[model samples]
Target: MPTSRRYGDACPIARALDVVGERWALLVVRELLLGPLRFADLRRALPGASSNMLTDRLRELETNGVLVRRRPAAPAAATGYELTDTGRRLEPVLDALGAFGSTLPATGAHLSATSVLLYLRGSGRPRAAGTYRLELDDRVFTVRSHDGRVVVVPGEPGTADASLRTDPVTFNALLADPDALPGLVAGGSAAATGAVDRLLAG
Candidate 1:
């Protein structure tokens, strides 16, 4: 953010970008969309982003009111980062971006958990209808798809027809091309059980 202060364009979009246009800024917000995360978890989720860069982004986001430190129930517990109401408003923005990106040719780039989960929300219908829990890296989310619509929320599923475990990168690969699932499973690169086909298929 060496020159992140302002766009000075006065356009609404430019002003909005002025707040979140920095590299990894919107990504930080995306990671917190489902819930909160400690700095370490954020690092794990975004391995490509350097610690110093993330620190700067966090500080800038906080200053701009997009992020806030969570109040721990116990004083000794660690503080985590969660999005403010203004930050949550970016959900549709991210969703629209994901949908738009999907229409383009494959870039073979890595996909973040947030991006992959949003993909499911938009168009990934379950092979069989039911609730399922997804443990992606350091986070857990519940997904349910029916009538060609999918829904995902933070945390474990109360009861599920299936369960899954995998890092987001591998999950992205598996979903992008279902044909690779067998090799991925055999190679121990990805693992999903209990109606595996239902949870990961579109």
Candidate 2:
């Protein structure tokens, strides 16, 4: 069993923090939320963590009743880790954390083109069966879904149906508060051309 921390006060928030307060623990949960269930997958998602540390954290979470392991049936011989119902209840907490992080000072670094592409890959709404394009500034991007997988490629201008041309900082601000986009753009702090409006509409 993992060692449990003791707090004099019985506040639920304190209790919950005690269980997950260790370094990389919450990130492990974030990887699980992104649909990686196997130990190897979790390890890959958290690049610098050692196998031993991963094992210990997994054991701790399981012991705390936040996660459970199950063997796959039939052809797949893998054992996967999944969140318990108690763990699933942490989704809102994670989402709120994400929202909070978006407002932090360093969040602007996460608004790169690759990050935007990954966000679209993970959360974009599917379109009618057809290819679409996205453009930002002098760069052009192509978006297509093949075999239920979304692909984003940087290419020439006319390739995408829409384009968004805003700097990383402005984009982060807009994501933090969509209503503020126009003011930023109007103030010459950011600029958008092509189908930028359509991309923001969603």
lDDT of 2 at 171: 56
lDDT of 1 by residue, 35-58 (tens): 888898888778898998999999
Q: How many clashes would you count in candidate 2? A: 3
lDDT of 2 by residue, 59-165 (tens): 88888888889878867677888888877787678767766664777622333343445455545444333345554334456666655566665564355554455
In model 1, what lDDT does residue 159 have?
Answer: 91
- Highest lDDT: which candidate? 1
Off-target runs (Cα >4 Å) in candidate 2 are 1-4, 74-76, 107-201
Lowest-sum lDDT 10-residue window in model 2: 107-116
True-structure lDDT of candidate 2: 0.62
How high is the lDDT of residue 182 in model 1?
Answer: 76
Question: Each prediction's TM-score against the native?
Answer: 0.86, 0.53
**What are the lDDT scores of the predictions, listed in order?**
0.82, 0.62
